[model samples]
Target chain A: MNDMHLCVVNITFLGKGPYTFSVGKGECVGLTGKSGIGKTQLFRAITDLIPAEGEILLDGRASASFSPTQWRSKVTMVPADSSWWYDRAGDHFPVKHKTSLLRESCMLLGLEPEVLDWQVSRLSTGERQRLALLRALQNNPTVLLLDEPSSGLDAYHTGLMEKYIGNYLRQNNPAVVWVSHDPEQLKRVASREFRMEQHRLYQIK
Target chain B: MDVIALTGVDLGLAASLLLLLSVLSVMLSLGLERKIIFFGCRMTAQLLLIGLVLRFLFASGSLLLVLLMSTIMLLAAGREVQARQKRKIIGLSGYLISVCAMFVSSFSVTVLALVVIIQVKPWYTPQYAIPLLGMLLGNTMTGIALALDRMTDQLHGRRGEVEQRLLLGQSWQEASSDIRRDCMRTGMMPIINSMAAAGLVSLPGMMTGQILGGTPPVEAVKYQILIMFLIAAGTGFGVVSAIWMSGLHLFDARHRLRLEILKSDKV
Candidate 1:
């Protein structure tokens, strides 16, 4: 673990008030909100994937100091509906890292190893969601942003993901901000929890 | 040798032949009678108007007048480009982009043709420059417009996919490489097809006109070839430039896709 910490300053985006928070290395923060409360927008703003005015710091370094590519690679997001551009699932993963625990990741999500060789269009939503997270984990991101990551998974797969993510955080020590609708799931995975009210996040647990 | 001139009565006699065709269309119930009559009237009016203005323009031969005509053509072409896009950016950005592309492409190609290729003594001679510029601008405008429109639509349509790549450490350039290539291909394809089909399926307009005006067949064919090559160059460059410049503008220094840069409307 690098003792890295993800710090966010007053991020005022999408008519949401200035948001301030910090997630330390090996720590996971759970974010819960109703539909369209600008939860995903917050993640986008933090990742600099969209336009916003604010400051985000990773390992005490301002996002401005990193190139867009470097910054995004450091702060990776696994969107609720994972996007697949290529024909086969394996094509989306970088060739150098394609086999890096690729089978293990599939197993962690209760998927077959052959899922990687399958066409993207043939994958179930749950498969796509798990693969999307595995892809992010493969990049060794400093900050992992998950937006309803387990929304498509059933209870069994979600539990598996929870176990995998917990072990991943303990091993890599990257800051994780997980957005989930299930209260029980939050209690299981998050070190701290926050609830959204009026387009802002408030610490609840 | 001078080509024979037609009297007004002679033209009317020729026009009557078109009327007979329209009458045949009506009898056949081809449903093209109104379109035939409308197109015939419009063509006559449009050609006569151009003939009158071109007579003045040719006689005056003022460089400033030629430039003014050129700017007007560019603006009209830009507006046409803006109007044709189904998913256009909102604001004057479309106009700015379309005109910028036209200026960057057609201007350079026209200058290259006049100075380097033709070496027309006065280079800016309206007699040579204006007609040549008109052809280049019109073709280049269509190509650029197609590319810009297609690229914009795709970027917006595939917003999720592109943003996802951006989130996964890809820069705007990498994220959009496929869409940009596809758009440029769409833009350049029409001209490439037209070039392939030019002489075999139908005689191109300029060649037909030259042959009708008593130029030798070989000379007309040669001129047509030159025009086709020039058009290909101008259109290819224009479409590429338009897509690249506009694509650059659509994103920020942070490599974030700036949808806000585009305005939507009927132009």
Candidate 2:
């Protein structure tokens, strides 16, 4: 359909089962699976982080058409445990995104504008996770690949994160592939749901 | 001034000094006693064999013989570089890259000095060519080894950071820019320090040997200066080429970090 923003057809990686799926604009497709059932690998393969064998399309264009960096810019992933190379938390961001948009994203995600000034080592896991979301958002990605974006957050911060992501989806109309272990969170955020089992993706009603 | 030739008796006196040191190491319960004696014997044997070979090389005076000797030296240096790395790239590419880097840097610099700078007669004269190549190879080998060792270790230790950058839409070069710069600095550090410390902190081995051989002190110092500059340039080029090649090898065609290709050494 013309509304399709991200599409995966028979993708397979690490000798796992071939996975086939697609997500439309403004749709959050939540994936739930047991630990080590290839959920993260699936996300990696979709984003071309790892080698995979299958066709992945973004906005009716094959991923192979763009360079890896170009493709990833449009389909960014917020990993569960983010890493920081620079000392200051703000230095990790691209300069163009360090403007007011970053400040606004931080406030919406229940983070302070001053958090950017803090040393990366001093930031708590929750703060790092939230900043990682902001980092992904700054790319203006057309499709988001989220792996446990709120795993480090408490209930209150989780609500704020969910609201921030929801607002982002409504405004940008990006297709999101969210992998979460919490069924309740999936039910609240995802309109179409799927569960990963033995590397295969199954759509759930 | 006539140079004093070292005789067997003189060398025997030096051997007694080593024996005394080894005995002292044993008496002090130092673990280096056996290593000292073993390495001393190994050094003697290796030097004697090379002396005989060099004599024959110089007598034969053929360009083919000189090239053969140079190739052998390059191979030995390549093996030394490979052995020094704790984590090495899998397959022959690792060996090839090291050898190629040394060959490009050391050989070219040695030839340039012989032909243009020093203007030595016959250019490939073993007396001048072999020693110069040997020094360049030795220094360049160490620089390459240090660079590659630091590179693999840093890449493995910072895997999470590298992948995060990749997911954030960075090219392989952009993701690895800091690591490349760090490795280059590590490789170049020793030569830079040695150059800084030369003449003041310690007498360089070549200048000391030349002076001991009864060459004018000022002449020996001039030669030492040339050799030092040559070694620095060789090491610089070798390290840069090796690091650049290794950097390219770190990522796959699609710009993914294929850390799997590096085989970790068993400590």
Top TM-score hit: 2
Candidate 2 local lDDT, A82-194, one digit each (tens): 99999999999865644687887788888998899899999999999999988887778999999999999999999998998899899999999899888999898999898
Candidate 1 per-residue lDDT, tens place, B1-267, comes to: 567888999989988998999899989999898898899999999889988988998898888888888888889888998888877766787688888888888888888988998899788888788888888888887888789888988898899999988988999999999999999999999889999899899798889988989999999898789878888988888888888888888888999998877666643
Query: What is the TM-score of each predicted model, taking all chains together?
Result: 0.91, 0.95
Model 2 per-residue lDDT tens digits across residues B27-114: 9989787898899999999999999999999999899999999999999999899899999998998898899999999999999999
The DockQ of predicted model 1 stands at 0.80
Candidate 2 stretches greater than 4 Å from native: A1-3, B7-13, B16-34
TM-score of B-chain for each predicted structure, in order: 0.86, 0.95
Segments of candidate 1 deviating more than 4 angstroms: A1-4, A95-100, B1-46
Per-residue lDDT value at B118 in model 1:
83
Q: Score the docking of each candidate (DockQ).
A: 0.80, 0.84
What pairs collide in candidate 1? B89-B263, B90-B262, B90-B263, B90-B264
> Positional deviation of A26 in candidate 2, in angstroms?
1.1
| C-alpha lDDT score of every prediction, in listed order | 0.86, 0.91
True contacts kept of each: 0.90, 0.88
